[model samples]
Target: MTEILGLYNYWIVIFLMMTGFYIVIARENLIKTIIGLNIFQTSVFLLYITMGKVTHGTAPILKASHGGESHGVEHGVEHGAEHGHELHAAAEGHVDLGVDAVKEVYSNPIPSVLMLTAIVVGIATTALALALVVRIREEYGTIEEDEILEMDRNS
Candidate 1:
């Protein structure tokens, strides 16, 4: 359906989330579990990025087709005179100087910024997990969960 196709990114996020969860729950290898965690993290990132997007949206940058100091000053003076208020340039003079004609939607940037931070934290967590796994392997001489459990039981 059109609705289903329109939300394809959500579908991908769901698939990746499930696949990662399956790997984490079903696999015994620590490295594979780390990979699964990474996959799960990526799914979260994709979800956030997708949620932050807007249809036909542009960046949050302001594009001034008719904006300048003179325009702002003139508009401000006119607005003040019409409203019978003494609006100074610093108060409300430059409120709608150049962006009144711009009706473009802008995507939210907070989600993307938070996801970027999450990505860095995820990488650091993965590295620490892998390092711990390496130490475990060195101490146990095996990376298999069952074998390690058996070794522990015997010891």
Candidate 2:
């Protein structure tokens, strides 16, 4: 299952996205509409998160705690403590660092960064919409679009 998931995760995410889009477009109730929108947005996030996942690739950020670079320097280690700098050399149990593993298997970082910005935009839109809903409810005593329409027609 893991193999299949790793292979076709993009298709699954696309399917979810289409389903959520259909729900958002077909729904009528205002609150239900908002829920559908949330689902659609979440599906997009899932797609990005799925793409960001790498089977063996390391994280984008360099951390001191993970013994990546700074940790090696602080441990009073010799020149070859961390597998040395030879391009063809491999660590005790790991693959050689000469090969560009990140470039080969990992998705691009630009997409991940763009998706994070999109998520922030989605959250901000949702919050602003909710605030508008609250204001509309206070003014009309109802949050339903149809009810608001009826009130407008009667007035």
Q: Which is the leading candidate under lDDT?
A: 1
| Cα lDDT, all candidates | 0.81, 0.68
TM agreement with the true structure for every prediction? 0.74, 0.61
Q: In terms of TM-score, how similar is model 1 to the real structure? A: 0.74
User: What is the clash count for each candidate, in the order shown?
Assistant: 0, 0
**Candidate 2 ranges with C-alpha deviation above 4 Å:** 1-7, 61-107
- lDDT by residue (1-155, candidate 1, tens digit) is 99888888899889988898888888788788889999988988988988999889876565565346546667667877776747554345355543453465778888889998999999999999999999999999988888999999999
What residue pairs clash in candidate 2, if any at all?
none
Model 1 off-target regions past 4 Å?
A: 61-94, 97-102
lDDT of 2 at 45: 86
**Candidate 2's residue-wise lDDT over 1-155, tens digit each?**
99886668788878888887887788576667777787788889888777777667656653334345344333423434555563223242233321323344544576679888998988898888788888888999987778899999999
